[model samples]
Target: MEVETENKYLEPLFQDGSLYQNELKCDISEKISDILTTITVFGSVSIETSQPAIIYKSKKKIQAQILSAIPHHPKSIDTISISLRSKLPFPAISQSSFRGFTVSPSGFIVLSDTSQRLGIMNSCGTYDFIKKGLNSYNDITFVDDITVAASTINAIEIINLDSKLTERVISFHGICYGIRYYNGKLLCSVISKGIQMIQLSNGQITDLVKQREPENWSYLAIHDDKVYQTTSNYFVRCYTMKGEMLWEHILQQSKGVARGITVDNNGIVYIAKYNGNSIALLSPDGQRCRHLQISDTKKPWGLHFNAITNSMTVGCVNGTIELYDISYSH
Candidate 1:
């Protein structure tokens, strides 16, 4: 017997020209029978009566298609909670002026500072420094599994992690502060130029947002189709990829200046309060907020959350790097 199928063109994953990076979670407790009933158009389940019925019935309760579970979108979550796990020992750097850092999918970290070198390390205390063809590093982001792009005074350099060599350089008229990689493009903050997008393949640059007075201390993060940014004025603004501002929030004067900004797997915004000595968590809708106190340090400058391991990496202005495990509750 042959099964006939029609040729139907599938739509692009992101239909509205927006980038979506929602992580999918599997529910091992879900039974195939339940999945069938839930997916049936009329809410009916047909019995699978065949020669293998008896054998399948014996293991019906057993977990099947565990990896094929439906996606669990955290946007539907009502509340969230966080706690600091044991801090991983980050190797100390002498006379370090930390700027930013990014964590790769495999847990490797690459940190940039205002020095002539970039520090590459992991949570296990393994660390190394790359010091060739570099003047001053400001912000850094991972390009791929074994490559990273770092911004400097007036340019962005792409370097290989394994070889630790500058593969290419993307020059700019002004200083590039914060940088992030998404969907084969680099979103950058160039002083006086606002938010810009770079095409990695052809090096074409396009402006996403026009900044009247672009601040040098601004940072940005992307979640799903939205971009969250923080400015030196302690203002956090959410914008679409086309530069449409959706909502904005200004940190209370007591919370200090917002320096580092990141969005977790659940779409919650986390801002590092540099002088406030705390991390502020903003709800997805930008309506509610809570704080995570930092007793050990007061100058958090960079933040990166790893959804795979449920951990976060914090880089302080004093060159202190710490990894924290985040626990969430509904």
Candidate 2:
């Protein structure tokens, strides 16, 4: 007996005229399913091999299609279908729009809303706690299981989840957009001032990278020993732990505003484009691999990668969140 195969081409619609002039396309050989998923004209699709899933925006919702029935022998993909398991309509964190989001190691989601509220969503996607009266919380990261540090305009606050007490840990004179906590230190991206490392113990500030010509960074992510930052000038740069430049890659369709950056365990960089309504993946060495369009997202802001579950959650400007099962193999 012989197995049959079919070639399927995934192409961007480009209907909104936001896609770059270079046509983005991918070819996959697989057995097509009769049950079609409704995808919108301006959505993004992420193909991952680690978990063998394809996540895309369909209409106003995001759906995950899991690929199964892989032949043990050398063969193409046979019978792709949508898995009944999915996360839809993430529990509302606030009445206002969400500006930042991060997932704790224990699987809880920390989100900041435009109305000065910080919310914690449990693994089941239900709000566990909501803390109000914050000063425009921008981004959040866990300093510990019961403690989280968040960024405001020019300050970083350490909040105790159990008691709901917020303390200003570090304050600077520049605008801070992105932050990450690691090894008792906080790495932050300050506009026009480059990246800064703050000692969590003493609240001491040290410049990691000074501002250079033509670009100011607003997003930061660290993987292994390397630190990553995305700039307002359409560039993604990598630096050593000692503040040495490694490589930089300029995005194809970025219109001078880039936000929401995260690095996977494999060192692949995923960034959200504020003006392009898209997300781009870059290789560890700064190579453009693929670009995805998120139709329902405007100015996608927060990007968080859950290493434990291999999931990526994105917060958009319209107060909605999209979660994807990111496969790291591919």
Candidate 3:
């Protein structure tokens, strides 16, 4: 299930106020217009390991939502292995899974948020590139000009966007969760499997560090030879590149959750805490910056820092993206 849209003038529509959610399709240049989404879950959003939210910077605040539903009708696949449960066998009904977002270096942004609809968007408007028979890809990274990685549960795929195909780059035990490339190697986020580091030159995989104390995987970021990892509790742990736990910082005194993380050229870390409606900027030495704060009483999901302009971009769960200056004094 894929849907694509192509418009020659999405940018001007957003600029002229002719396309902010009402205009068929347009770029989200402001925080207030990322994506007007609706969420419906058959199960708990917290129970499952999901990447339902990701923050990125383009002309707009684009997003992807994960949905789960019971199949109305069952269909047989090419292969099926059944075992007895209690009174009968269980059937496998196919559903959908999504991966990380792809911010194109080529200035083309592709939105695969909902299955059956994949959007090729730019500042002007959008170009739809939806088709059937594509695998559910999770976690995307542009490795170089041609190579890209799409992570999923069973395999880590190196895909050629030019060819539009993927093959397993490596295999893992549990879900091959989130991944990011920093300083040449691929750092993978795992559920109960800790952080796995794979050298892209060769497919050699090794555990950089194992997650201790908690049974959940939230997010991971690498900067200044430190691996900043978070738990479901919004408790952040800064560990050495060797996986040594260095220090911990709690964004808020409460039991809230923090997901999105971005750092600026000044080594200031910004946190996006959902439902808390706050974005925090922390010094490289772990001190909170007094002036760099954005609070709206509604949880924010994504953030991006632009050093070129000395500003930060924020995305709210309530359908808005806002940019604020960190240079202002309190």
| Highest TM-score model number | 1
| 2 or 3, greater by TM-score | 2
Question: Which stretches in model 2 have alpha-carbon errors above 4 Å?
Answer: 1-96, 212-217, 254-256, 296-299, 328-330
For candidate 2, write residues 129-171 as lDDT tens digits. 5687547887888988888888887788889888888855577
**Candidate 1 pairs with clashing backbones:** none
Candidate 2 has a TM-score of: 0.68
Model 2: lDDT of residue 294: 61
Better of 1 and 2 by lDDT: 1
32: Cα error in model 3, Å = 94
- Which model is ahead, 1 or 3, in terms of TM-score? 1
User: How far in Å is the alpha carbon of 56 misplaced in model 3?
Assistant: 49
lDDT (0-100) at residue 113 of candidate 1? 62
TM-scores of all predicted structures: 0.76, 0.68, 0.57
lDDT of each: 0.75, 0.70, 0.52
| Candidate 3 residue spans exceeding 4 A from truth | 1-99, 102-120, 124-138, 213-217, 253-255, 287-299, 306-330
How would you order the candidates by lDDT, starting with the best? 1, 2, 3
